[model samples]
Target: MQTDAANPSLKKTLGAWHLWGIAVGLVISGEYFGWSYGWATAGTLGFFITTVIVALMYTSFIFSFTELTTAIPHAGGPFAYARRAFGPSGGFVAGAATLVEFVFAPPAIAMAIGAYLNVQFPELNPKTAAVGAYLLFMTLNILGVQLAATFELFVTVLAIFELLVFIGVVSPGFSLANFSAGGWAGSDTFGLPAFTGIIAAIPFAIWFFLAIEGAAMAAEEAKDPKRTIPVAYIAGILTLVVLAFGVMIFAGAAGDWTKLSNINDPLPQAMKFIVGENSGWLHMLVWIGLFGLIASFHGIIMGYSRQIYAQARAGYLPPSLAKINPSFRTPHRAIIAGGVVGIAAIYSDELITFGGQTLTANIVTMSVFGAIVMYIMSMASLFKLRRSEPALARPFKAPLYPLFPGLALAIAVLCLLTMVYFNPQVASLFLGFMLLGYAYFWLTHKQREAAPDDALLQTARSLVD
Candidate 1:
């Protein structure tokens, strides 16, 4: 018997622009914050080189990932691809990694939102504001995808404009000497320490382009995802690459790049260095920067919910999480479930530290660890699908066959290895979560028969063609 699992309850209201907004919005917060942590580890020049390497990896990965996105268009995104490629075990690994990435990311963004708001009202505890943001945006996502996407597009545009304005204002103060003084990890010459610093900084550089692939989670809600997703992914990646480099360079050069390191609200601080704290430009950044953090926070709430819903529907998660709100046609249960975890993480900020890092930095590293694992699984899925299902209809193929996917896979593996070596505490936490998830999955998943492969394939083909 064919299952309705293929035809999900989500509304198909998102268009190309909506998908693009989700793609970019899911990652814009990186430009505003989190990425500065890389500077603390690698120095300006070292982190710059590290970002270049990470950017190249993302560029290649996105080019290769689009083929699977268009062909499957499943809400599970990477999880679905791995499931089809390697079976239940593979799907579990990808799904758990995606969950870690999406779930952990919003807490970090929420803390940034608090930090931004605290700029205007110092009396307001950032943690309180962070908890409030979780409540507000989770409610919005539960309302509907169209409403959420529209709001995301509007804020994403404003955030982009704000970044451009920031770069313009800071350009006057961009001093080459200030940026180059300690560029190579505060040493006149590069050495093994500098090399290790770059390796340690890979996660933070990854912060710049972390969740762009989350747009794939919205494929089921997009209007003709096969056509629209390719446009969104391609345009989205290019838009991010340019913005990532622009924000990092000009912000570093605006003042002593050293001062900007190890802070959450780097943009306003960078602007303050150029325009002074009392300048109207600095004030504008303090307020408008909220949009950047909000966009990513809201967009990720949407992403994690869809992921929970998909896995639940497929029997990988608790079945009750698959329930969609009848009135809203949204995953209300799934949305709230993820929000609860995010809020707990917000409260745990500062209380949970690793190796002298802040909550935001530690959580950011954890999120990146998950992202690297997911990327490895996704690229591997692409290669497997190409060989196993040659006739599968692909609307958009990767530009370079073995080169793009292979590069992404190789880099992903390297990043994961380096992260484990540098961050044993956070890595242990990540591994523990994965193992707990796998244990639960193995114990319970055997009780129920998952949807037949033939039926799901037929459904995916129907949706794609």
Candidate 2:
């Protein structure tokens, strides 16, 4: 509903390219490379089918988000949009869900980094690796958003190059026989009953395709929020979809899908086999690409911090989080808050285990649910905004109007249902968190209503003027 006055000095100097670069960097790094390895278990065809389904879901979600961002074009993506549609209470749920989604992202990335480090230094402690990566990114984020964005751009280019090289080297060695060696429909490795195995695999697929909405969070910071945000959103999704499919096809061709499934870091292992053990140069490049995954984590923090700041300014969160650094002209407090959560997640992952599972599983489980909820809220907000503010100017309208958003909403619901049906424990925990968010909103609604309206007016005027 409002951008904080404390953040009034924050400027929108980021051009469309910068925004697109950040979005692509984040999606590719976070969802594409960082998490796609898990899909290896399903083999190439399974991975391909899953990727296509997830990519469609991703693209549809972005379309819905684009429509919302175009209409609102504020600091918070869903949070701000939901506030405009259903008032402060709805905003709080949206904001909290988004905050949870982002707060979990950094640590998940850190865990991935730790996993990658194990490739280079098999003897190193994963806990230490996680902490080291967290501290590095925390400092980068604390320095300022621009610095983070610049670093992310460099890392993103390198990461892309690394992936391209990987594809190039591995393509020649790919064996189609390896792909179809194991039946595509079922596998003994999963251990679950046939139907259960397929259901169990949904989370891995969902995780691989998450974060397309990261672009929407950068909407307010874009040079031309209206034009840039929408184009970047769609373009970013398209880029990742292509890259994901390419990587899957290449991976299938390069080696036995059954063997690749067992290797956690499929790219490096595949490369080592394809290019031979002496290809030290290619190995180093893979490591560089891992750093790009680090960059993706950085980008997610940047986008999510801005969303948190926007939520705080709009009265859905503690006002202190809205504070901006004069020099950086960014939501310094919000960034720090997000970094703190990330750091905590690292600690929790190091110390906690449930049912023989590590904290990464918990975080991933919760994050998926939170992400899905935020997405649903966003789609619902689109319909609400259309009804509430029919005259609202939208620079970019989702093609087919209601059809796109409706499809996205349906797919999101399907994902949620599948997640719940497959893993009730995580689904329950995530739902409990959602209910808590709603309760927090209910308790804060009166206070929010009593807050002065002038701040909202001022914030809106600053943006339009």
Candidate 3:
């Protein structure tokens, strides 16, 4: 078995503050967009019901998940935890699910960024802007970790402030009348369709807290694993909970939630309810909202690169992916590899429409598909490790022990079933990717090196010198 030798190669530059920033940064865009899609299916009030339920699940899920992250403290995050509890196949599935969540997410955001830019310059082709975003951010990440993290902190703070501004500027105009006007678009009453819509709204609601677990993926680079992960995780989720409900309720009241429901730029559209569509305030928000997209887009890139680098170094992917840049000591190859894949996803979405879903919405559902699977696996890992590895040196134990994890698992299973029932096409795509990744792993598992995350990189370092 490999030890903690993965530490020597990666820099330890992140503290609890950075961890908090990262946790918020990765999911802040959710506060601005995506959640509105729930309005389309479940209407305003129904979506609120969905959000409340999902919020409780996340509260329980994150509390229990911190136990696994703190005890294991691996860059592979849930994958490492699942691997310890259930072995190689479990690790691959968890890792692939994470790959699905983190890797597929950026293209969806890149498209949003492109759409935001389109509002500013109508002539700028969205596809071109998205590709450009990938290139610009990938280069920044390849340059250095501290530089990337600092940028992440800056934009995340900016985006948070902007959300506060939006709430303040739009608050006075909020009306219950506006909120309820389109409260039940598709359903006649609280019947089967309404119930299914509530269940189907799970993915969009989960989008509010999706990838908040990504904070765990940064465990390898954090200052103090036991202290930082707990403080950051707790703070991070509380912060998002406030922001999520704030944005959802306020935005819903500010305008007809149905109008902004399926649009790519919900914040700007919601502003139309308070200020005229052509108001300078809406224009300003469109400008600032770009930062919200960048915060998530940039932060998730950091996450995916680290995940890929960690897994590849552990022999789960090609050795080339684990290689680090000698000058910057950053995972340049992994970052570029992720960027390329994201750009490819962008073009593929433009080319095909799956299950009558728009490229952006389908991609978002695909990410949620991975997120639900990861939640189930990670919750199970926590439950199993608690019973099996009693003396695992947990610095921050989950509050309710078995109850918390059990509830999270049950809720996750319910949500997963609901998501599959509603979006079979996206679910199939997600499952197909998992099967393909696992097949490759099954064939190559025997050839893997018996080393920790960075042993191969160490060999390369020695050869270079």
Candidate 4:
């Protein structure tokens, strides 16, 4: 049997421009909406507090994270690092957590897409529109990586421009009084409730920075990952940080920050303050916002499919998932497989009611929970790999070393604890998902070849030669 890497394999066609597209494309939606949910928990100033802390964490995390990504440069991202540092079991856990993050994220973005469409066409059911969005994007992804990335680039550029437009339009209307309108949530003032609100807001704060790490997942597809990954990752996270803070401040001040706090389309709502509800600019924001969501939705599907391909190629998943399209040079089977799971999760409550909770509510919790796990594991792996493989020919090194990664690890652990405490039911659900992942690993993942990491790394080396 010719190995998967040798047959119908990934093509390294992505450069710094394309890599930046994938990086920003995978996370640009954060600027449009989702992050505002922190306001519901922490209020405007309180959410700002959460955003600042989470931003620091992602900053430290990304800087330290590039070191691992450049050194290993595998499609599995965090899994590749953990596997190198820990072994088969650790690798399996990291990969599974990654699947959780990538797999569920699309459906959440799909929900947003549906909501965005419903605003324009009130007759359309959100769920129906969501499923259609999935089919459209997945088909585009399966057709070719270059085409999909080109589309990603187009939409990401448009999305960023619209965001800048939003800031400019809202600047005159921005008010310090409105920004601090609801400084802290709940009936109780500054006490345990305020502190807990900040803690509870962690996941929503994370929504701003969620899948930025996903750029690293495209290591296998980057033209020159050693030079490209660090550039894209660093520049990408910084862009998002500025966007996150900018959008939050402008949106909060433009209108009733309370009303715009947590919704599918906060930008439209906030823009209403300046442009009026029926104005052309407000409508423009609504339509363009759909593209923003699509950018991340489409980009992350590409991210997850690569991860699915990597896991299957290594025998952690069924072999069929490793099938690459001979013409497109993309993992066609993995793309379809992940799309099916996303569609299923879209209607999971309808398929089998899980406590009557919406799929986005239940599923996004898992994605965030899983993202935190990958962060902690990846950062820890950074430290371990440094100690264990001091001479492992690293092309890019983290700027602050122990300080950068240590801040990342500590903040990640804090967020994980906050997520569990505030979201007990969903946290329980995440634990259940982990158990299922463990069961799959125990039954079929023993007898490792110890060659996949070396093989995956060699795939990166091949890009240069």
User: TM-scores across all candidates?
Assistant: 0.96, 0.88, 0.94, 0.94
Pairs of residues clashing in candidate 2: 174-253, 174-254, 175-253
Which stretches of candidate 3 lie above 4 Å from their native place? 1-8, 185-193, 350-352, 449-465
Against the true structure, whose TM-score is highest?
A: 1
- At residue 180, candidate 2 shows an lDDT of 55
Q: Against the unseen true structure, what C-alpha lDDT does each candidate score? A: 0.90, 0.69, 0.84, 0.84
Task: Look at candidate 2 and tell me the lDDT of residue 299.
Answer: 84
lDDT of 2 at 337: 83
Candidate 3: tens digits of C-alpha lDDT, residues 91-111? 788888999999989998999
User: Cα miss at 94, model 1 (Å)?
Assistant: 0.2
- Using lDDT as the measure, which candidate wins? 1
* Worst lDDT 10-window in candidate 1: 447-456
Clashing pairs in 3: none
Cα-based lDDT at residue 187, candidate 1: 40
User: Which 10 residues in a row give candidate 3 its minimum summed lDDT?
Assistant: 456-465
lDDT of 3 at 432: 88
